[model samples]
Target chain A: MTLPAHGLPAGTLRRVRIVGTGLLGASIGMALTRQGIDVELSDSSPTAQALARDLGAGRLAEDGDDAAAPELVVVAVPPDVTARVIADQLHAYPTATVTDIASVKGRILDQVRALVEPRTLDRYIGSHPMAGRERSGAIAARADLFAGRPWVICTDEDTPAKDLQHVVDLARLVGGTPVHLDADRHDAAVARISHAPQVMSSLMAARLKDAPMDAVALAGQGLRDVTRIAASDPALWAQILDANAVEVRNVLTELREDLDTVIGALDGRVDALGVLASAIGAGNEGQARIPGKHGTAPTVYSTVTVLVGDKPGELGRLFTEMGEAGINLEDLQLEHANGQQFGLAEVSVLPAARGPLIEELRARGWTVPE
Target chain B: MTLPAHGLPAGTLRRVRIVGTGLLGASIGMALTRQGIDVELSDSSPTAQALARDLGAGRLAEDGDDAAAPELVVVAVPPDVTARVIADQLHAYPTATVTDIASVKGRILDQVRALVEPRTLDRYIGSHPMAGRERSGAIAARADLFAGRPWVICTDEDTPAKDLQHVVDLARLVGGTPVHLDADRHDAAVARISHAPQVMSSLMAARLKDAPMDAVALAGQGLRDVTRIAASDPALWAQILDANAVEVRNVLTELREDLDTVIGALDGRVDALGVLASAIGAGNEGQARIPGKHGTAPTVYSTVTVLVGDKPGELGRLFTEMGEAGINLEDLQLEHANGQQFGLAEVSVLPAARGPLIEELRARGWTVPE
Candidate 1:
C-alpha cells in the first residue's frame, strides 16, 4: 500500500478498505492510493480482488477474515448488496467510521436503520458521488475519479459533525467537490438529471437499432452525441433502475405528458405545439443555465467540414496547418471510408475564425469540396 | 453571376434565385455559386443580401423592376413565408422551375399544388438537405454545407424525371448523397429521428435553466453533452415544430405511451425498467445498425484521463508523448478549466490499450490518477 504523498496532515488517512472492487470502488481506491493513503481492497469475488491487486489499486484483504479496523471503510457494493454489507461491517468493525456510496441514499438509510444497532449509525454517513462511467468492473477502476466532481454527502440530523468532516476530507483527498444535500433532495435531483437521462438515452439508442441501414447511416452527430451513454452495462444498470424504479417512473411520466401534448398539437387535437414548445423551450433555457468550467457558459461553435486523405500523418498535417494559422479549434469530427480511400473531417472553430480559416485552408493544398 | 466553372452540358445549372439569405439559403448559394452556377440572391431584408454578397456566396439580385428571370428558383424561406413566396414567385417568374427547401415536404407540397400552374409543377422538386447548425443567417453559411450529407428528394407520380435529375444534380453538385423517397415516408422518418430529438433535447435543457445555480454548477459532461443541441434558436424551431406538427405530434405521442409504460413500471404497475430497458435496448440495436462513414459501424472507445498542465503547447507535448509511445488515440477530450491550474486531459483508446496507456503516462511523469 502507498503512503499519503499529497502532504496531508500526519495520521489523517488511516488504512482504509473498499469492500467492492467495481467501477466506484476501484476508482476510490485509485484516488486515495494516489494521495499516498494506505488502501486495503476486498470483494466477495476473489476475481475482483485479484483484478484490483494486479492493477496495483490496493492490497487484498484475507478471505473471510475481519479486516483491520481502519479510520474509514467505504461500502462501495451494488445497491442490492449495500445494506447487508454495511450491517455486516458494523458488526465486524465497530470502531471505524463507515459510509455507503449508493445512488439512492434514502432506501439504503432505511435498510441500515432497520438492520444495524443505533450506536453504529453515528459511525456511518450516506453519500453518492455524482459521477460514473458507462463501463464497469475492477478492470475499469480509475483513480482521481472524483476530482472536481460532485460528491453528495447525505447527512441526517443525527450525523456527527466530526464524522461529516472526515467524509469531507475523504472527498477532498479524492479531489471531489463535496456537496451536502438532504437524502431526498439528492435522490430527486439525480432522478431528474442522472437516472432519467440513462433511461432516455437507452430508449433513444434502442430505436436506431432496428432502423434501415441507409437511414441509420444518415444518422448525424446529434443522435450519436445524445445516445453515447446508452452503451452502459445492461446487468448493472438493470439493478440500478430496478432499485430506484419509483422516482425514474415519475420523471418519465411527466416527460410523456409533455410529449403527448406536443403530439396532440401535431394531430390538431388541440393547440399543443405551443405548450410543447414552451416545455421544450424551458428545457433549452435549463441547458444554458448549466455553468461551464469556473461556472461560466462557454460559447458554442459551429463545425465546418474539411476533406483530407486517409494516409497516416494526414491528420497531423491538418492540425499543424490549423495551429500555424493561429486558429483555435474547439472540437473535431472525423469520418472515413470503410477501406480508407477518402474521408471528411469537420473541425469546429469560434465564429470569428470562419472566414479567415476557409481562405487559409484553401491557400494550402487542402481540397475542401463544394 | 459566375457560371458553373465545371461546365456541364448547357443548362445543367440554371440561374437560381433564393428569396431568403439565412443559413440554408446562404449554404445553397455558396454551394451553387462555387459550382460556377449563377444564383441571384433575394431576401426581405437588404442586410441579409449584403451579408451574403460580402461572403461572395452569391450576387444580390436587384428588387422590383430589375428582378431577373431565372431558369430555376428556390424559396429558401421559413415555413411561415413558404406558401406566400411560392405564390409570389409564380406571379413574378412564371417560367422558372420553382421549389422550396422547407423541412416538412408534405405541407408545402399540398399548399403549393393548388396555387402554382400545373405545368410549372413539372419544374419543382421538393428537396431538403439533412444538415444544420446551432447558428443561422448568411454569415454562418459554408460553400460545402451539403457535402456527403443526405439530401431527401420527395416526388409523386406526377413529378417529371427531368425535374428530379435537376435536383439530383444540384444535390450532387453540393456533395450531398441524394435519397429518393415519397413525401410521406420522408415525413415519418424525420418525425421519428430528427424532430423527436429536437423536442427531447429542448426539454432536457429546460430543466437546467430553472435549476439552482449550485446544483447547476455540479452539472458534468453528461448533461452538457445531452443538451448541447438545445442552444438552438427557439423561435425558428417553434416555426419548424408548427410546420411539422402532425408527424412530430404522432412520434411524441408514441414516446408518451412509452413513457407511460415506463412510469407504470416505476409505480410498480408494470415492468417499467424492463419496458424502458426494452425500448432503450431497441435504441442500442438501432444505433449499432447506423452505418458510420463509408458503410462501416463506428467503433466506440472508452476514455482514460491524465492530468496535464494548463500551459501553452502542453497538448502538443502530450501528443508527442502519445506518438512516441505508439498509442493510437481515437479521441481526445481536454477538460477546460477557467483557472490556470491543471486540466483533466482524457484520451479515448481502444479497450485493449487503456491500462497500458495509463501505466505509460504514469511512467512518463504525467499525473495519471488511475
Candidate 2:
C-alpha cells in the first residue's frame, strides 16, 4: 500500500481498531490507514464492515485474532449504545488505549464509569471531533473529514497521561487540533454552542409551517440563515437533544425569558422602547464576541456590493478582477432577488482596501454603484 | 447631464420629490437620478440632504417653489413619523401622487386615515421596498440597492387606480418587482418573514453574552447563522418591532409555545423522543417550503467541498478553474476552522454536474476528499 505524502512519522500509532463502520468510524479508519497505520474495521452489520473495507478504509477484522492486537481501540457507535460498546471494547482489548467519539461527553462518561472498572476506565478517553457532513453511512466516509477541526479530549485528575497522549497523538494523526477539557465542561460547551442553536433554528422554522404562501414568499436572507440547519436529520437531533437535555433546557429557558421581555414590551409596557432597544443591543454585544476566521478577534471588514448577471463565469470574472487588484476577499455573499436576472456579489475586504478596489472595479467597467 | 445608457422611456415621471435622505431615501434618489428622472431631495437634516445632492442623488428642493412642482412625492421617513410626513406632503403637493416607503404599512395607513380626508388619502399610496444596508444615512446609499428586490405596494379598495399606477411605475423604473398587498396583509407578511426572524436571532445571540469564553470558543457555522442578524442596529429594529408589535408578538408567542413543548419533552415527559422528533420534522417541512434563489421552488444542490489555503487569490484561482470547467455555481459557502491555515470552499452545483466537477477539481491538483 502506498503511504500518504504527509503520513504520520514512524514510532507513532502502529495499529488501530475502529469498532463501528458508520460514517465517523469509516472516516477515522480511512484517515489512520492513509497515515500508514494498520486499521481493522468491524460493525454490527457485516455488509457495512465489508463496504468500509472495500472502500479502503481498512481491512475486515477477524474475531479471536490475538496476533493482530491493536494498539488503540476507537468506539464509534450510536449515542444510545456508545457506552455499552465502549465497555465491551475495553474488556476485549485490555492493553489498548480506548477512546470514544461522542458529541455529548458527560453522560457517556458516567454511563461508562458505571459499566467498567476503575482500572479499565483509566485507559478510556472521551473525545469529540467537531466535524461532519449532512450525509451519513460508510459511503460518505472521507479521509480528511477531521482535518482542521477541533477534537475535544475529555479527561480528569484520575486519567493516565500515557493513555491521554495516545488519544492526542491519534487526533493529530487524523489532522485534528486536540483541545483539552473535562467531560462536564465539554458537554456544557457543546450544549451552548451547538445543541441550543439547533433547537432554536428548528423552533424558528417550525413557525413557517402554517404561514400563508405569500408570507413565506416574502422570506429573505435572514430567515434563510436562521433556519438552514433545521433541515438536519430529526432522529439524530432527537438523540442529541435528549442526551444534553438539561443544558439545552437551561439555555432555552433563559432565551424564553428574553423573549418574554420583548413580548411584554411590545404589549405596551411603561418603558417599552427601552426594553426593546436593550434586547437588540445585548444581541449586538454578544454577536460581536464570536471569533472571526482563523480564531482571531472579530474584525469588521468593509463590504463592496457589485452587481453581476446570473450566469456562469460572471463570479469568476469578478473575483479574478479582485485578485488582479491584490485585494483579498475577507468574506462574500451572493444575493439573488425574486424574479431578478442578476445578483449582488457583496465582497468584503479590509477597510483600507475598499476605496481602491471599488475604483479599480469601476474602471474595469464593472458596476460598482456609489 | 449626459443621458443614462438605459434611461427610462420619455414621458414617465418628469419631476419627483423625496423627503428624509436616509439610506432608503438616498438610494431611491440615486436610482432615479441615474435613470434620468428629475429627483428633488429634502430632509429634516440639511447636512444629510446636501450629502445626497452632492453625491448625485438629486438637486436640493427649495421650499414653496411652484416652478419645481413634482409629479410624485416619496416620504421616506422613520416609521414613527412616517404617517405625519405622508399627510403633510399630500396636503402640500395637491396635484402630485404621494407615497411613503415605511416598512410597517398598516399602522401608518391607520394613522394617515385618522388624520386626512378620504379624497386626500386616495392620493397617498404606501409602498415598502424590501431593501436596506447595514450602514445608514446618505453615505451608504447605492443606486442599485433596490434592483431586483421586492417593493410591496399597499393599497385599499378605495384607493384610486391612478395613484397606484404611479407607485407601480416608480417601482419598475427603479428595477424593483412590485408586489400588491393591502396594508394589513403587508404588515403581517413582514412580521412573519422579516421582523420575527430578527427578534428570534437577537434573542438567540443574547444568550451568548455571559457565556464562558471556552463555551463561546466552540461556536460553529450553525451558531453563526442563527445569530448573524443579531448584529443589526438596535434602535432601528426597536422602531420596527414596536411598529408591528401585534404581528411580531403573535409569531413569537407561537414560537414560544413550540419552545415550551420541546422543554417539556426534555423534562422527561412520556414519549419525549417522539415530541422532539416531530418538532425537528416540522422544521424540515417548513424550511423545505422556503423558495430557493430567484424565487423558485427549493432545489437541492449537491455540494463538493475542496480545501483552499487561506490567502489572497486562492478563491479566485479556485473559481477560475470552475469557470474553465464550465460549471455554474448555484451557491458557495466558505468555512474556516479555528486555528486552521486552510478553509473549506463548499461549492454547490446541479446534481448532474457534481461528479464531473469533483473529478475536474481533483485532477487540477486540488484536495477534494471523498
Candidate 3:
C-alpha cells in the first residue's frame, strides 16, 4: 500500500533511521521495512543494535560514531532521555525530519522547544502510538504493531504542515489512525484514560500484598482482570508516570475526591450516597460508552457457565462451536478446577444466542451439565 | 466425582434442594449432579424452574407448592429478600439444613436467626460464593459456576458439625474451595476482594460519561480493559452494597483514607511522596501474593502484538498457534483498527517464550512485525 499523502514519495525518501532498538523503535522499523521502506537502525548499546539487526528490523548505519544523520530520524527513547536525544540529533543532523515517540507529549514538546533551535523544532512533531505490551526491548517489537491503534500527533502552528504530514505518513504506514490534538489536551486525555488506569491498577494490585493468603487465594478474575495492567514494567512506567506527573497528579486529585465522597457515603454522611452513586454511575456511563466487539456497545445479555475439562482443546471446542454457530461471545471465564477433572467455563453471549449455543454444545458430545 | 468425605458422609443424606435457579443455585445442582447427587429444584418464578430444567441442572420436584423436607436446603435469592426467604424455609422445613447464597452473609444470617426457630437456627450456615458476574438471573446460571471459586461458609459453634459438614459438602459438590469464617470476617474479606473492586470499577467508569467524544473515541484498551467490570447489573449491586453496609462502609473508609493520602501526595504535601510510595508499594506487595495459573504465580513475560484482519478465525488462528506452541497467554487485547485492513492483536505471554513464538510465527509466513 502506498503511503497516504503524508508519506514521502518513493524516490524522494532515501533513509529512515530509528535511534533506539526498544519495543517501539523496533516496531516502527519493522513496520516501515514491511512496506519495503529502506531504513537505518542505531542504538548506543551494541547488544541492542545486534538484536535489532538479527531481528531484521534494520541495518545499523556506518556514520554513527559521534554524529550521524538520516533522511527521517525517529527518536524512540525513554521520556527522560527524549529531549537530550532530540537536541543532540538536531546538532548532528542539520537536515532531517525528527520526531520522538514519547508517552507524555506536553513536557517533551516544551523541553525540546526550550532546548533546541526554532527552525530545527519546526521539523519535529510529537506522536504517541496508543499501543504497548507488558514486556519491553527490541525483541518484543512486531512490524504491524501500530495497526489501527490511535497514533496521536501533537503539533502546533509552528509545526510545518509538511513535517506534520511526514509524521502522519509514518503513522499511516504503520497502519495507525491519526489523531491530532494539542500537546496539553493529549497529556490530560491520556492521564484520564491511559496513565490513570495504569496507576490505578498498580495501586489496586499493591493493596493485596498484606492480605491473608486465603484472601489472596480467593482473588477472582475481577481482581486479576483489573490489575492485569499492574504487571507492566515498573521501570518504564516510572518514567512515563514521572514525565506526566502534573496531569496525572491532577487526575489523581479528582479521583481522591470521588473516593472520599464514596467513603463518606458508606460512613452514612448525607448526600455522600448521591455523590458516590453518581461517581459509580459516571463509571457506568463511561463504561457503556465503550464500543464492544462490533465496534459498538451492544447490550451484554449476561453470562452463563458450562463445565468443561481442564485438559487441552476444551476451550478450543467450546469457542469453535460458538463461532461456527455465529454466536458472539462478549466475555468468558475459566474457573480453574484446582483439584477436579473439569473447570467451569463461564460464557457471556448476547441475550438471544445463549439457548441455541447451549443446545448446540449439548448435541456436540460436550457435557453441557444438566 | 463423589463428594469428599468431610464428616460422617453427611449422614445418609436423602436430598438437598436449591430454592433458586440463578447462577449460584444452578451451579450447586450441577456440581452435585457431577457427584452423582440430584438436587430438587424450586423457584418462585416458573421461568427459572423451566430454565433450570432445560439446562438439566435439576428435576422439578412435584412438591413444588410446599417446601420439601430435604436433609439440606439452599436458599439462593436476591440479597434483600434472602433473610425473609430463609426464615420462611425454616418455618416450612424445620429439620432441614439451611443456607442462603447472599453476597453479604452477616446481615442476612443475623436477621434470619432472629426470625427462625432456635432448633432450626442451629441447622443453618450462611454462605456467600466469592463468585458472580456482571449478569444474573437463571438464564445466566451454569451448574459449574463455583468450580475452584471460594465458598465462604459463615458459622459459629452453635452451628452443628453435621450441618457444617453438609454445607461443606454442598460447597465441595459444586467444586468450590470451602473457607470457614464467621459472618463478619467473611463479609470483610469479600469487601476487600469482591465488593470493593466492583465499587471502584463502577466509580472509575462513571467519569467517562462526560468525556469529550474525541477523548472517548480515543479510549484505549486500558480504559476499556479496567472498566469492563463496571458494566454490571446496577440494581443488583445496589442491594448487595446495601446488605453488606457495615463491611462495605469500613472498607470504603480505609480506601478513602488511602485515596486521601494519595491525593495529598499529589497536592504537594511534604510527606506525600512517601505516603504515595507506600500505597503503591502496598499494591505491589498485594499483587505479588495473588496466585497465578496452576495455583502458582507464573512469571508474566511479554505482550506481543499481531495485526490481523477483523474477520472470523483471525483470533482463532492466533490462539491456536499460541496453544499449539504450549505457550499459555496471560491476557489479550484486540484493538479494532478503526476500519483498517487489520486489527492490532496484543497477546500477553510468558517472557521467555516470546522470541520462540515470534520466530515460529515468522516461519509460518505471517508478517511478524520486527
Q: Write the per-residue lDDT of candidate 1 for residues B1-370, one digit (tens) a residue.
A: 6665456534456667888888888888888887777888888898988888778668988657344577667788988779778877867886666667788888887787777777766666788887877778887777766766788888888877666777777777777878888777787777767777788877667655555565566566676667777777777777788888877776666666666666666777776556655655665666665554444467767678877655434554565666667676565555643322456777777788788777887888888754
- Report every candidate's CA lDDT: 0.72, 0.87, 0.73
lDDT digits (tens) for residues A37-70 of candidate 2: 8899989999999999988899988867997688
lDDT tens readout by residue for model 3, A2-44: 3623444443344688888899999888888767676788898
Task: Give per-residue CA lDDT, model 2, range B204-288, as digits (tens).
Answer: 8888899888778777788888899999999988999999999999999999899999999988875778999999999998899
Per-residue CA lDDT of candidate 3, range B1-370, in tens? 4573554234335477888888777767766765666578888888988888777677887754454367788998777788888888777776778888888888887898788778878877898777776657665666667767678898887888888888888887776788888888778777777778777777677666666666666676667768878877766776777667677777667666666666555556646445545665566666767776555353455766676555444555666666677766655555655545456666666788788878876776565554
Question: Candidate 2 clashing pairs?
Answer: none
DockQ of each: 0.37, 0.71, 0.40
Better of 1 and 3 by TM-score: 1
TM-score per prediction, in order, is 0.87, 0.96, 0.86
Model 3 CA deviation exceeding 4 Å by range: A1-13, A64-69, A271-279, A293-307, A318-335, A338-341, A344-360, A367-370, B1-12, B29-68, B116-119, B268-281, B296-310, B314-338, B341-370
Model 1 per-residue lDDT tens digits across residues A1-370: 6576556555456677789988889888887877777788889898888888788777877655555467788999988889889988877777777888888887788889899778887788888886777667877667756666778998878988767877887787887778899877777777777777777776666656555565565566676667767776666666677777766666676667666666666677776546655766777677767765543455566566787665434555676677778776565566543323456677777788877777888999786633
